[model samples]
Target: MTGRFGRCRRIAAALLTAVACQSAPPARAATPPDTTARASGVVTWAASADRMGEGTAGQGYRLVVHTSTGGSDLRVRFTNAFGDRPLTLDGVHAGLRARGAALRPGSNRPLTFGGARTVTVPAGAVAWSDPLPGRVPAGIDLVISLHTPDAAGPATGHWMAMQTSYTAQGEHTAEESDANWTRTTGSWWYVDSVTVRPARPASGAVVALGDSLTDGWQSTTDLNRRWPDYLARRLTASGGAVRGVANAGVSGNRILADGAGQAALRRLDRDVLSQPGVRTVFLFEGVNDLKAHSGVTAADLVTGYREIARRAHAAGKCVVAATVGPFKGWPEWDPAGEAVRQEVNRFLRGSPDFDAVTDFDHVLRSPYDPERLLPFFDGGDHIHPNDKGMQAMADAVGLDSLDCAR
Candidate 1:
């Protein structure tokens, strides 16, 4: 009887242990943290890079740019995309612009790559600088000073900056005064884009992919009066989520052919999709294609637009398209080209591929002559808009439409 009681007690204890084990929750599997939630910097200003003239050895460039969104930890990108040999930049500096070729006192700061003072970018490649420990204010003129010690190949830069930048004979990157920088050039060399870390992690940017009109071809020099510039001002004043603006416009660029710069299709990834913190792509091109008379029909242009929209969508970006503006008085204007423009604009307005559409044609066209640009807004060449016209184009854009879900 004692042995039987012992056995029964043992069985009851085993059953209770099993019941307790079953009642307890299973061990939770460890979840990995989401790194994508972290904020990288957003591009505050950008210019598309192309093949400039041959690079000069021991040359220093004081490139001035206008910022659209202000933020901390400012960074800059240098392009060697058109270079045939490795480009070595020995000195690089960033500062606020006090005047022509002059930096604000005590604002000049040094930049590095991998914690080193010098960076070597291979041919057909680009390099980004380490973040500087300061804030860059919105709509401010920022100057980037760089010196290439052994640069002797095809130089990569923006040809029609429409802003005055300075060049010197030797390494004067550390200077804040205009004593060393005496020569002025209407271009930006080496440096392409500037980025900053905004306080809000949700802040995003839009890239204006266009041609000469978008490149500020005829706008007042050093005034930052491009249509995108006007748009940036509006965005800042409105206090909207999309505060950054990158102008990826290359003058004389075409949609299907490589001419002034790589065709819009070829350079789309580098100029638009690859930009950091970009939520939208504002496409305002195709004039060159129509004007060139390369047998490019409206259907062909539409196909190109579809491809661009498709690629941008795949990259999780919203696409906003604009109708081609009037250019009847321009030298390249013809009835056939005008017809093609009309058809393309119609397709852009009704296309479901685009998240939004801005009718720039309606905004710039003359009421008296539908095919011609408005005289008051024409920049004299009839293809590009003056300062007032640029502002009108920006005003025509619905700010709310820029903040679209991708």
Candidate 2:
């Protein structure tokens, strides 16, 4: 969240009163057949079009399907974060392609819904495709195609998805007979997750909430190492005991006001409230407020965090707050801002709002400067953490709180 740009930033400091959030009714107990063994969850990678800017190329924007030689549902999520006008979608489809560089539409498959031809996405809106009614057996490639009205920005994503989604394309199950998959990179516009659930009793989910740092800009393509990914690896090591992590970081997201990515308050609905089976949240945002925004103070950051906590508590979910790590020597660091960072860290460490507390700042900071990042952990930019540093973050947290329904 480098405060280098000029935009309204649209930080939804005020909550959206449109949707009444009463509460998620308690999940019903599992039946005799569906045991805790069948539980599942999803890890969602989130980002806004404006947040990525023109930084990333779309070459990496791809949706890959991996099934166990059986048929499964293909679900997708589309975003209109940068859409200044109505996003007119002519076609949305999925297909299979070969492994060569000339990644033309490997094969052809059409993704359709209720047999409709198009979907118009409103500005700043997200649309999910109904689960494909088909099944994809294992050992195959399913590629989702998105034809947008304009070019994507900041970065593109090419990764294995966790949830089921629908693009403008129709049912992306094993049946993409009329669709096509191609080799492309960069310019990925938005992100989503997908999964298949049969007669499962429960699912587990991780909430990774933060700014551009949490979004993982330059780390690597499709190699999910954005801190939360590391935590996912840890969970996987637990052997299906933990479900998955859902990422809620927006690029350029700040704690106080809206500017870069939708500010923390504005996106709580789309990122947090609307997530499926979310049980825990990891918070490592706010350095941007201390460094980028000029009028921000400790009180403002605390107030914003308190609101986040209240929302999480009301949802019966656990909130893990990480101290704002050191960023004193960043290309954009301000000395006064450093003071505010320290002050805010003090409050987060002792605050009762968070159900749990993690010391990311203390673990990733340099001993020499204390206010700068550890040399090895720096992702060149003093703002974000490197892969190894991200792994350290996972190790430092008390992940036991996410025990699956045993």
Candidate 3:
């Protein structure tokens, strides 16, 4: 009996040892966080800057602008490009617009430069604000309130905003109410561009380099009805990879000469290429150059186009050309200018210098009279198109072509 009990105990011990000797399954390595969609940054909204007028010290500007693409980490760029002296901006805030000169409750936030609320931009230079936390939705009116403590000399701003902004005598940038902002202005001060970090790293922006037609001069004021605005809406709705749109148009701007503003060629670097994540440069100017009878032949205009294309290509950006629309009834229109326009259109249609071509002339011309704007689309100027015509032009753009590789 004793021998049998000892043998049973040994067998039990052997079974326990066998179970402990077996190896356990290895634990799975923790899954790493996905960062493929994280974006570096992209320009969501922008306007071309020009010399507005003399700057007023202690004056606050509540500039309202429409955003094209939505994202987080908002940033603003202030320009002193045309200033002859250093521009000191003490207070700046950005918020969602509730109404005229009023911001939505809890939306107004102070903007900083290098972690400070104040920044001094040197003469003929620009400054970019540090990124602000929070997300901004697309197609919304963004109100930027800023105060210049020592803004003297020439003020660098966009002259024709179409949208009305407000002004106050003191530093009213922190206030969300419109009571302090009693004065109205038709220009955007200092601030030129706004950028956001999109969810997709592949997201990019397109800058429309043109004249008044692209600037929404004839479209209804306060409404974002420009062709570039329409294009932005279309891009958002279509869920395209290229979603941002920056309008770099100036009223009466020319391609070859400096008149109303710096020529398109001269301002290309500051107005278009300098914007973050710019994938394409959409060239649509030339009408003003030909209509002015500045001895700018089709060949000369084509050379300007080629130079723009070459510079854009050097910057690793795609170039898209648009044919000039018809304007037979315009006072500037003449047989000589019409001939130049036709020749330029032909070259734009067949040019290999551009990655893509948009035939704006074909889209805007009247079927009854090919040399004139469609009466339904004309804004009564025989040159600029109304809102409907602007939408049509935006609709005519091929979404796929905008994503061309450089």
- What TM-score does each of the candidates earn? 0.90, 0.70, 0.90
- RMSD after Cα superposition, model 1: 18.1
lDDT of 1: 0.86
lDDT of 1 by residue, 334-388 (tens): 9999999999999999999899999999999999998998999999998999999
Q: Candidate order by TM-score, highest to lowest?
A: 1, 3, 2
Total backbone clashes of model 3?
0
Regions of model 2 farther than 4 Å from truth: 1-72, 81-91, 94-110, 115-117, 133-142, 149-184, 190-195, 198-200, 403-406
Q: Can you write out model 2's per-residue Cα lDDT over 1-406, one digit (the tens) per residue?
A: 4451111112111111111222322222212221112113232233333444442212223344322112234445565555544443434544443342211222333444333434555556655554444443223344555554444433223222222223322222233332333333443445444444322335456677887667765455445556666776666566443455666666667866787656877777666656655777677788888785477899999999999888877877778889988876677787888889999999999998887788888998999889888989887888677777777877887777654222
**Decreasing lDDT order of the candidates:** 3, 1, 2
For model 2, what is the error of residue 238's alpha carbon versus the real structure, in angstroms, after optimal superposition? 1.3
lDDT of model 1, residue 123: 89
Between candidates 1 and 2, the one scoring higher on TM-score is 1
Q: Give per-residue lDDT, candidate 3, residue 361.
A: 99
